[model samples]
Target: MNLFNPSKRVRNLYIKYGENPFVLLSKFIYAAHRQKWSKEEIERVISAAKKGNYIALIRILRSHTHIEE
Candidate 1:
């Protein structure tokens, strides 16, 4: 995923969900859980997300799930 230039789906998700890191982090965690991600993987993503970078977090989410456009 492009961290600097977000895709259409990512943009839509960002707009729909807003830029709140906490909210996005929850969604990411949910997606990760739905995908049956390993605990370590989930924790790593959570760790990365704690930095509170919107684009980076969205990229991580996009990597794990399909964000329909």
Candidate 2:
């Protein structure tokens, strides 16, 4: 997983906000809602995000945005 190859939107958010975990987590939840991701998937991603796993964050965001789930 290339750090720069996942969700461009999320990467941009990180670049813009300097990787605030809470803010990114909030955005991930909001985006999951908007993207209609499953509750389980959202919860899983949220859990991972809350743990401060950037790789999980990127994977989940890419999965949501790119329909990889």
Candidate 3:
């Protein structure tokens, strides 16, 4: 699930949706692409979630309180 080497689905999404994360990383038909959360962002979420699992990240808030309210 390396964001570095995007999968075919990601490449297609990137081409159709462009490089903006708002699209490519939004709904790429691949959970891995969606879950390819950045380490920094994950850290922030971790600092907030405090031992949270990846499943709760969809809401972001549930995963990370750092998310601007």
Candidate 4:
């Protein structure tokens, strides 16, 4: 996936949850847990998300999770 330019799936997610970081973050966390990600990996994503750039957070989550379009 292109990191610099958002893909169609990512754009769709932005449209759905752009204004709600909490909701997006929750989903990311849930997905991480469901995938049985390591604590370190989950913590890394959470720390990155804490930077308050939801777009980047979404991109990071997308890279880590398998979300259908």
lDDT-superior candidate, 1 or 4: 4
Q: Highest lDDT among the candidates is held by which one?
A: 4
lDDT of 4 by residue, 1-69 (tens): 322234212222232446577777777666656666566766776776667577776666565454356
- Residue 64 of model 2 has an lDDT of 39
Steric collisions counted per model: 0, 0, 0, 0
List model 3 lDDT by residue over 1-69, tens digit each.
221233222222222222333342233324323657555553443344224343333333321212222
Residue 22, model 2, lDDT: 67
TM-score, each model?
A: 0.52, 0.49, 0.25, 0.58
lDDT of 1 by residue, 1-69 (tens): 422224212222332335677776776666656666666777765776556567766656565445455
Local distance difference test scores for all models: 0.55, 0.52, 0.33, 0.57
Q: For candidate 1, what is the TM-score?
A: 0.52
Cα error, candidate 4, residue 21 (Å): 0.7
Q: Pick the candidate with the highest TM-score.
A: 4
Consecutive 10-residue window with the lowest summed lDDT within model 4: 3-12
For model 4, state the Cα shift of residue 38 in Å.
1.5
| Candidate with more favorable, higher TM-score: 1 or 4 | 4
Question: What C-alpha RMSD separates each model from the true structure?
Answer: 6.1, 7.2, 13.1, 6.0
Better of 1 and 2 by lDDT: 1
Error of 2 at 35 (Å): 0.9
Q: By TM-score, how accurate is candidate 4?
A: 0.58
Where model 4 places Cα greater than 4 Å from the true spot, the runs are 1-19
